[model samples]
Target: MATLTPCFLRIFAVLQLAACSFPEEPGPLISAPAEVVRRYPVFVGRAHRSYTRQEPLYIQTVLKVNRTLYIGARDDLYRVELDHVSGDEMFYSKKRTWESNKNDIRICRMKGKHEECRNYIKVLLSHDGGLFVCGTNAFNPLCANYTRDTLELVGEPISGMARCPYDPKHANVALFAEGSLFTGTVTDFLAIDAVIYRSLGESPALRTIKHDSKWFREPYFVSAVEWGPHIYFFFREMAMEFNYLEKVMVSRVARVCKGDLGGSQRVLERQWTSFLKARLNCSIPGDSHFYFNLLQSTSPIIRMQGRDVILGVFSTPSNSIPGSAVCAFDMQQLARVFEGRFKEQKSPESIWTPVPDEQVPKPRPGGCAVQGSRFSSSNSLPDEVLNFIKTHPLMDEAVPLLGHRPWIVKTMVRYQLNTMVVDTEAGPHRNRTVVFLGSTRGTVLKFLITPSPENPYSNTNTFLEELEGYNPERCGDDSVQARQPLSLTLDKPSHTLLLAFHSCVVRVPVARCQLHSRCMKNCIASRDPYCGWTKGSTCSLLRPGTRLPFVQDVEYGNTSHLGDCDGEFVNLFGM
Candidate 1:
C-alpha cells in the first residue's frame, strides 16, 4: 500500500471528526420517500380572534373525542358536532367577558362596570372528569369548568391571582396529566414567566416557573403539552435581535416527568429537558419581521391512534421562500431526543422538494412542490447542478418554485407549517404520520407515507391526493379550493378526519365517501358554501316553508347570533 502524505492524513482526520460530531444524517427513516395521498378543502367558518390590527397568531383544538370537536379562538371556545352519516353541526360558547365596577352609582343602575371584556379561552381536560378553561379577563386570570355532558358551567368561576401582563394579545394555558396547568403571560414584546398551578380538589395552588431574565432570554410562551409516563411542556424562545434579520427563531419541546411534581407547589422545581429543538428557518427571504406567533393558541401535540404521541409545528420564513411548511418527529424520536441521546446536526434550516407525479396518489395536472426535503437525498443531486447554483449566485437569489428542479432550486421553495399522524395499523404504519402545510398565500396541503419494499426505514411516496379532488376550475366552483387549515382531528372509530379552518368545516372519509351525491348536493345547496360541495349536482334547496335540516349558532367578538337559511339559497344560486 502506498503511504499517505502528512497533509492527506490531516485532511482525512478532519473529515472523520466532522462525520462523527455532526448528528448522523437523520437515518433512512427521515428521508424515506413520501407523496400526497389526498388534499381536500376544510371549512372552519370566518369567525377569528383578532387584537388591534394583528391577526391572531394561533388557533387550538381543545378537545377532540368521539365526533365532538372543541376549538379555542383567542379568548373564546367553539364546538362542532359531526354526524358520521351527515356532516357538521356547529355551535359556539358565549364569549365570557370581564367587567369592573368602580362607582356605586353606576353599579346600582348597571349590574357592574366591566374593566375588560375578552373572548380568549384556553382549555384543558382534567383527570378528574372536568373540562378546565383559563384565560385573561380584564387583566386577571379566570378559570371555569363545564359538565362533561351538557357542557354547562359546573361551578362558579374561579379566579387566579396571576394577571396577564402583556398586550392582552398573546396569553395561553396548557395542562399536565397530573392536573397541573401552565399559563404563559406576555407583555408587549416580552414573554413573561409561565404561571403554574395544580387543581387541589376545588382550589388551585399557584406558583411561577422562573428563570433569570439574562439566562433564559425570552420568558416562556407555553405552546404544547404531552401526558404519558411523564408530563412535557413545549415553548418558543423569542428571536434574538440579530436573528430577526435572518428570520430565525428557536423552538423548544421540553418536558418534566409527572413524578417531579407531587406537592402543593404550583410550578415544578426541576428544569425542563428538551426533547427536540430547532431553529425555525423561514422560506420567504427578507421577511424576518413575519414571526410565527403560534405559541399562544396552537396544539403541537396530539395522541395518534389512541397511544402514540404526535408532535407538529409550523415555521414561517420571511425571506424568498413564500410559504409556511410542516414537519414532524415521532414520539420515539422525541423520547430519544429528550434523553439527550439524539441531537439535530443537520442544517437548522429545512430543505424543500417537489412531489414526484408518480408518487402522488391523485396527481394534480399542474406542477407543484411539497415543502419538505429527503434526508437521504440531500447529497443525491448532480455535482454540476450544485456547482452551477453556487457559481451563479444570481440564480440562487431567485426563490425557486415547487416544480422547477435541479433539486436545490426546488428545496428553496418549501417551508414546514403543521403536521399530524393518523395510524391505520400498528406495525408498519406505527410511525407513519401525515403532514399538513400552509403556503404563503394560504394554500393548505396534505401528504402521507407510502410503504417501500427496499428499505425497512425508507417508505415510498404517496400524497393524500383526494384532498385536491374538488378543484375549483374542474368543478367550476370556488368552494372546493383548499383553505388554510386551522386545526385537524381524527375520529378513529369511524375512520373520519375533521379539519377546522378559516372558511368551513371539511370532512374526508378515511375510506371514500359512499354517498357522494348526498354529500356534494347538501354542500352546494346549503349556499353558505363553507364546505366543499361538488358542482353541477342535482342538489335541491328546501322550499321557503320547508324547515332547514340544521341551524348554526355562532358566538364571536363578544356577540352571538342564529343564522337562518331563508335567503341563503339566493346567495348560493347567484341570484
Candidate 2:
C-alpha cells in the first residue's frame, strides 16, 4: 500500500466530492393534466413584432361581440378566440392592423385640420354598438367612432375646443355616467397643476376647472378613476426635492369627488372639497436608498368589491422586488371625505383606511439556492463533472461548506411573482375570492380567499401547492415573467371569470360550491411548500489515498457509474 501526504489527502477529498455533485439529465417534459376550462387565444397585434422591449408598461383587454377578445399591446391591438374543451392551449389571431402610415391621406387629412396629427391609439373599447377610440395629438383629445363590422371611421372627428389648456402629456380621460366624459390634465411648466373637464351631449364642449389650492398644486399626477354617485379620481403626489441618494421621492394616494369639485359641472372655479391623502411608505427600513424605480407606475386604483376600491402598487424599484401589492380602501370612507364638512385646521385621517397586513398575502419565496457538494462512489471521474468544475471555479469553495456532502451543486436564482386580486359573487357559506399570481421562473399560484376568523376585514388565503413553477418550454424564451401584467375582468351576467395574461386568456367557471377543497387544505397547511431547505446531509472528510466505501447515488436510483461492467471481468466470485 502506498502512503499519501496530508496535502494530497485534502486535494483527493475535494476532487472526490466534486465528481458526485453534478445533477443528472432531467426527465422528459410531461403534458399538463386535462383540465375542463375554456382558454382563449389573445391577439397581440402584428405591430408587436416591432416592439422589442422586454416589458410592456400598459396592457388592457376588452370583450367584443361574438365571443372575441381584443388585447391592447404597446403599439397595436390583437383579437383572440378561446377553445371550449381545454383551458391550457390557446389560438391567437390578428384582429386589427395598426400601421403608422404618416403619409396616408386620411391620417394626414385628420391631422391637417387640427394640426394634431401624430396618430397613436391610446384607448380602445366596444361600447354602445360601436367602437369608441380615443387618442392624443398635440396635447388635444381626438375622439372618433367606427362601425364595428366595416371598421370604417364614422362620425365627425372631435377635438378639445380649448386645446386642453394644459400639456397634452398630462391629459387623461375617464367615462362618467350617461355618456358623460371627464378629462384631467396637469399644467404649470415649473410646478405641476391640475385641471378637470366635463363634456356632455352631442357637439360636447369642454369645460376646464382649475384646482389651484395648496393641496391641489402639489406635484401630483392623476392615475385612475372610480365611478360612484360622484366620479372619484386618484392622484399620486410626489415629494419635493428628488433624493438622488435614495433614488426616490415620497408619494401618496389622494382623491377628489364630483360634488367636491362643485357638482362636476362648474368649469374653472371648481375646487376639490373632499381630500383624502395618505403618505406612501415604500422605503425599506435601514436602506439609505429607495428600492422602487418610478412612483407613477407604482400607484393604480381599481374597483374591488361593489363599494370597495383596490390600489395596486409596486414598492421596490422596477427590478428589485419584481412583485406588486394590492391595497384596499372602503368607498364609504371616501364618500365621507367629499361630503363631510371640517375646519381647515382639522386633518381627516378617518377618511382613508390602509389595507391591513393580514389582508395581504405573504411574499412568496425567491428562486435561488446556495451551491452544495456531491460525493461520487466512482474511482474514475465522469467527463461532464470534470468540465463543470473547471467552468465553475466557485464550486471549489462551496464543496467544502457542505462538509464534502454527496450532493449536486446549484447557484442562487431569482424568479418573478406577478400578483392580481379579484372579487367573486357572495356564496351561501362565504364570499368567494381568488388571487392569481404567476412566477416568471415557472409557477402559477392560485390562492382561494376565505374570510379570516379573527379579522373581519382580512381573509385567510390558501394556495395550490401541487402546481409549482411553470414549465419554461411552454412559455417560450422571450416570455418575461416579471413584466407581464395580469388583468382580471368579471362579467357579472354570465357568472364567468375572464383572466387575461401573457400569451393566453383563461375563462374559469365560478361554481356555487367550492371545488379543490383537498388542494386548498393542503396548501394552507404547507403554505404552498414555500418553506424548506435543500435536502441531503453533509459528509465527513477523509484522508487522501484512503480507500473508502463507494456512496450510492440516492437521486439516480443508486446506480453506480464507476467500474465498467463492460471492462475485463475480475474473479469476484472467489473474493
Candidate 3:
C-alpha cells in the first residue's frame, strides 16, 4: 500500500489544469416500428378515500413477500394481494403523518425550494420475518418495526434523522444485510452533511465520507448492493478529476469493506479502512465517441452461472438529448478495475493519470484483507496499508461496460428510461432473459434478451410489449397526461410487475405470451419463452408437464432443429 500525503499539492494542481471543451453533436432520434409495440393489460390501485381535493401520493418503494406486495407511499403503507386475477388491498396503515411544520415549509420556501416537507415512509425493509420501516417524520426522522403476520407495529420508534432524508424527492440509498443497516443520505436540515454510515447491533455507528468537495461534490446516488464481504454504492458525482469549469458528472462505483471497524481514533479512526471508488464507462465504441453519461438506475441480476451482471439504464449528459440506453457489466469486469493500478495526479494541476502497473502499491490497499482467517478485522492490517487507504480512496482506472456498447438504445422519444429489472427463466428452446423497463412517461416495456449466435457470450434483445401504466379516468382528458414512474419492482412468485407512480400503483401480469400467441410465425417472432410453436401449426404457451416436438429457438432464430409446422400459411391482416 502507498501512503498518500502532500494533499495540498494535489489540490493546487487541480486548480491549474485547463478545461477541455468539445462541440456537442447529439445523435439522430430513431423510433420503433408500430408492429413491435404491443400493449398489455394493467390494474391500477388508488386510494379509496373521498376528500374535497384528491391528495397526491407517491409510491416510492415496494416489497413482495409471497402473495402480497408491500407498497410504501407518502404518509401511508398499503398491503396488496392477488385477488384471483387483479390486486386487492388487504389493508392500509397510516404509518406517517402528511403534515409538515409551517416553519419548515416557510424555511424551505425561503430557500427557493418548492417541494413540501412532510413525513413520508421512505424506508420499508424486510428483516427477520418482519418489517423495518423508516419515515421522514415532519423533518424529524423515525424508525419502527412491524410484524408481517399481524400487520401491526411491534417496536417503539427510534431516531432515524441520519438514516433517512426528510425530502421525498431527495436521492438516498439503503441496504440491509447480516442484521446490519447501511445507509447513504444527508444528515442535516440544510442537506449539506451527506454521509454513508454502517450500523451494526449496539456497536458505535461507523461513518465514512462527508460533504467535503474533496471527497464528493453533488453526488446523486442510484443503487447499493452487497456481494461477498463488501457493500458497493453507485452514483453520479461531479468529476473531481475533470478540469472542466462547468460541472462534469461521471458515474462512480464505491466499495466499503463490511468488516472494517474504522481507523485508530487520533491517526485515522472511525472511518472506512477500505473505501475505494472508480469511474464506470458505458460508452459506444468507434470514432464517434458516443457515451451514456447519466446513470438513472441499476438492477443486479445474478446469473445461473457463478457470476453476476449489473444492468443499468443511462441517458445522455445533456437533458435536451432525446435518448436513453441500457448497459450491462459483469462482476468480473468491476473486480478487475478495482484491482487495477490507482489513478493519481502527479501535480495538482497535472491531468489525472493512472499509476504504472509496477509502481502500484504492493498488496493493493483497496483489496479486502478481512476475507481470510489471518486478518478478521482492520486492526490486523498493517498500519501502512490503513494509512494508504485513508487518503487514496479514488481509483485511477475506470470500470468499462460489458460488450463495449449498450445492449439497448432508444432515441427520438420524449420520455426517458427511469427504472429496470431483469428476470431469467427457462425458455422453450433454451434459457431466456427478459428485462422490464419503466419510462418517465408512464410506460412499461418488456424485451426478450437472447444470446447472440455469432457471439455466444454476448446478447441481443427484441422488443416484446409496451403497457400503459396510468389509468384513463384518473389521467383525465388532458390528451397528454403522463405521470413519471417512481419505482419498478418484480413479484417473482406471482409472475407480475408492480409499477409505482405518483398517483397510483399498477400491477400488471408479465406479458401472457403463452396464452396469446396464435400462429407459428407469431410465436417465434414474439421471442417470448412463455409462448412456443407446436407441430399443429398453432402457437402454444408453455405449461408445467407440457411437451412439444417442435419449438422455435428464438435466440439463434434457427428452425432447422425443429420440424416444419404444417404448410406455409401467411395470414394477412387489414384490407
Q: What's the distance in Å from true for residue 335, model 2?
A: 3.2
Among the numbered candidates, top lDDT falls to 3
For model 3, how does the per-residue alpha-carbon lDDT over 402-490 read when each residue is reduced to its tens digit? 77767787765677897898777645433677788998777777777776677655676777667666554543321333367777877
- CA lDDT, candidate 1, residue 553: 12
- Residue-wise C-alpha lDDT for candidate 1, range 1-575, written one tens digit per residue: 99999988876765554344322211111111112212443333223322122343234345674566655555445554544222222333323322322342243235332423343454545545656665544444456776555566776877643423322445344554444554334422233554333334332333333543212345455554655554444555554323234533445454433323222122122222111132322222232332233332233455443434333344433432232332334455554433321211123343322223343222111112123633122123233333222221110011121211110111223333443434433111234444433332233344444434653333333333223312232112253223344445566554545654433445554432222224433333222211222233323322223333422111111112212333223223232
Cα lDDT for residue 302, model 1? 53
Ranking by lDDT: 3, 1, 2
Judge candidate 2 at residue 114 and give its lDDT. Answer: 36
Writing each residue's lDDT as its tens digit, candidate 2 over 46-73 gives 3233433353323333444555555543
TM-score of every prediction relative to native: 0.50, 0.49, 0.81
Candidate 2 similarity to native, TM-score: 0.49
| Local lDDT at 235 for model 3 | 89
Q: Which model scores highest in TM-score?
A: 3
